[model samples]
Target: GTDFPLDAALMLQEEMKAAFASHEFQEALGALHWATKDLKIAERNKQYRELLLEVQKLIVPRYGFEGTQKGMSLMLMAFQALGYNDDPTVDANTQAMNVLISMDVAGNALAERAAKEQARTSAALKPWEEVPWEVKKVEAP
Candidate 1:
């Protein structure tokens, strides 16, 4: 309604605070998206733009594909948590969430495969195969 950018930034900040306090990762991710949108509105030179980008990147995991998909999935989950289905508008939100969930599942599978490939490549380069080092190893005390 009022200057979408400014409104989005304020709303996003509020959402981010609430999500952090409530331990809602999904909501936090959604709030991060709002912050990104706000950055676009405030322009690249804005003081908060860098902070917003930093926060967005902070939530990402080591695996790029997995991180992206997880962030997207969290946003979808947050939308569902916010009772978006109750909105009077079209069923777009609900439909989109379903699609996001499916995509996330597929993405996770792909990431797993990629991780395996990376490990294989590393293992191939290693000289000592006698004492093998696993990619994702479970540490014991």
Candidate 2:
């Protein structure tokens, strides 16, 4: 997915840091403002982590992640940030459902799925991966 707002936000952060390093007082004031905003988000991120703890308790059983590796990984992450497992044995249907349920988990996986569905319904443009492509061409007779 495209990193629209996050990338933009990060660019703003970099701009702020550069301004601060430049030692220009006027520009540095804006940079300091940016740093204050970032600090506020940092505080919110910590609270979001706590909220995720309660939310995971609800999701774990509903998604049938009760006692499996997937469940274990999720639980472990709920306590602390860590990588997750990719159970190759998981079927496509289950994978699709998980993605559907977790559409907003990242840069919005839901955007891709919605774009494809809208394209199929009419002729709207779709994400590149959803576009048709041919691997080989046959010469005309």
Candidate 3:
């Protein structure tokens, strides 16, 4: 028996196949974006996380985040790559969105914050300050 999210996996597979066959890379990417959203909802499930990571590893490379710890999915990573590091300075109003998103009711709050803070720090650092070895290696090509 398979240890995968059978329904979601199969549906995504079929959708990807159809999109690729039709030369609809945009449609395929949209499908992947939704898949990532669904995976986030089921983050407690390791398989779901793996699936999302796999898709991200596959998709982000084409867009040029070839190597980074934060993975290539988040919007911030791309922005950072283009040199939009540093905290977006502004009044408290500008920080509200991030502050709200940063709150974690689960025990993983610290973990979440650490991840976000790390990403922010990484972003703020210039390319020379980035330690390539510190970033997690993508197991996939």
Candidate 4:
């Protein structure tokens, strides 16, 4: 069998591009923009946190780690568009940290899923045990 090496980085990049191009992501960004405008510091902080948490919930289960990473990366990339620039009201560093934590959690989940799948596959492929003597017995010579 031919072994073709997988290019993880390229695959991730493609996945990120697809996510960025999705209508759901576009709607989320639009909502983020609407949600962050004209808010007091406390309100903005709460809203931002909730929004990120919601995004994490949506991405982790379906897309796994790579998808979550792509989602967060898109969010961070659009910070300026989302009106989270150098505004004193917004804690950009903390938000970035939240994304990192989400990515780590997703990564662990993906690894665990992969391990389980591998175990299941290995068990399925195991050789059958020997037949019992009684079962194997036939007409004797």
Candidate 5:
């Protein structure tokens, strides 16, 4: 597992928030809305409440501090928010599949953002052409 620098993680968090405001995110949310349209009121309410808690769980710790445990918890909460469950006997496999797909989408978006930030940072830190390089000579080859 790659450990993103704290700065990179913060940048990713901002990028993800921006993504959530995009039309694509709205469309995805719309799809979720339609999918659950037929659910009983109580069931819908329960799922929505659970989803809210999971989203908060995913966001708070990571934004506050960076660590392997926090990152793992965020990922786990992501899956849960997308409706994953541990019960194999349940017929919610479709929700599990949706979670996997959502994970891929979110992971790719974050990775792309991180890579761009890394590239920008690397370019800024690169030595200017005016700076002379020092080459060490080997006594023997």
Candidate 6:
């Protein structure tokens, strides 16, 4: 196996987290974009795969969809990157689909409520309202 540069990648991830914490949106966006492009060499490596999911968990909501549960778009992207589609019964797929459904339902309900009560025309435009989503921790077998 090739020795992937895990240390550098981890450092970059930490830096991106700090940038976001400091409200340095530009840096965070750059980091998220770089991560989407790829931040590792070992796509087949288990550790690298985990890092990819972490990047997705971090990039989403803040930069993509709504709160984590209400937004599995990045998770779907991560699953695709990990080749989870090769198996029809993979729990990730079912879980992701559940999330997509919930996201849609939650979104519609929120938008309806907001429109009726607060005059918000779109729930997708409210990035300021998203909290960090609950992450379901699953260890790879």
Screening candidate 6 with a backbone cut-off below 3 angstroms (N, C-alpha, C), the clashing residue pairs are: none
Candidate 3, poorest ten consecutive residues by summed lDDT: 98-107
Q: Write the per-residue lDDT of candidate 4 for residues 16-92, one digit (tens) a residue.
A: 44454454654454455455556786886666556554545454344333234465565445444545545443454
lDDT string, candidate 1, 20-76, tens digits = 333244333344444444455456235333433344444433212123435645544
Model 1 spans > 4 angstroms off: 1-67, 93-141
Ordered from best to worst lDDT, the candidate numbers read 5, 4, 1, 6, 3, 2
Task: Put down candidate 2 lDDT per residue, 7-36, tens digits, no spaces.
Answer: 332333333233323324323233333334
Off by over 4 Å in 2: 1-40, 58-105, 124-141
lDDT of 5 at 61: 56
Please, what is the TM-score per model? 0.21, 0.24, 0.23, 0.30, 0.28, 0.20
The root-mean-square deviation over C-alpha atoms between each candidate and the true structure, in angstroms, is 18.0, 21.9, 24.3, 17.8, 19.2, 22.2
For every model in order, what is the number of clashing pairs?
0, 0, 0, 0, 0, 0
- Model 3 scores a C-alpha lDDT of 0.41
Any residue pairs clashing in model 1, and if so which?
Answer: none
Stretch of 10 with least lDDT, candidate 2 = 82-91
lDDT of 6 by residue, 1-141 (tens): 212133332333344344333424323333343344443545424433343345445644543344344355544565456554454545543444343323234345445554576644553555645644444445579
With a 3 Å backbone cut-off (N, CA, C), the pairs that clash in candidate 4 are none
Q: On a 0 to 1 TM-score scale, where does candidate 3 land against the true structure?
A: 0.23
Best by lDDT: 5
Off by over 4 Å in 6: 1-83, 91-104, 112-141
User: Each prediction's Cα lDDT score?
Assistant: 0.43, 0.40, 0.41, 0.48, 0.49, 0.42
Count steric clashes of candidate 3. Answer: 0
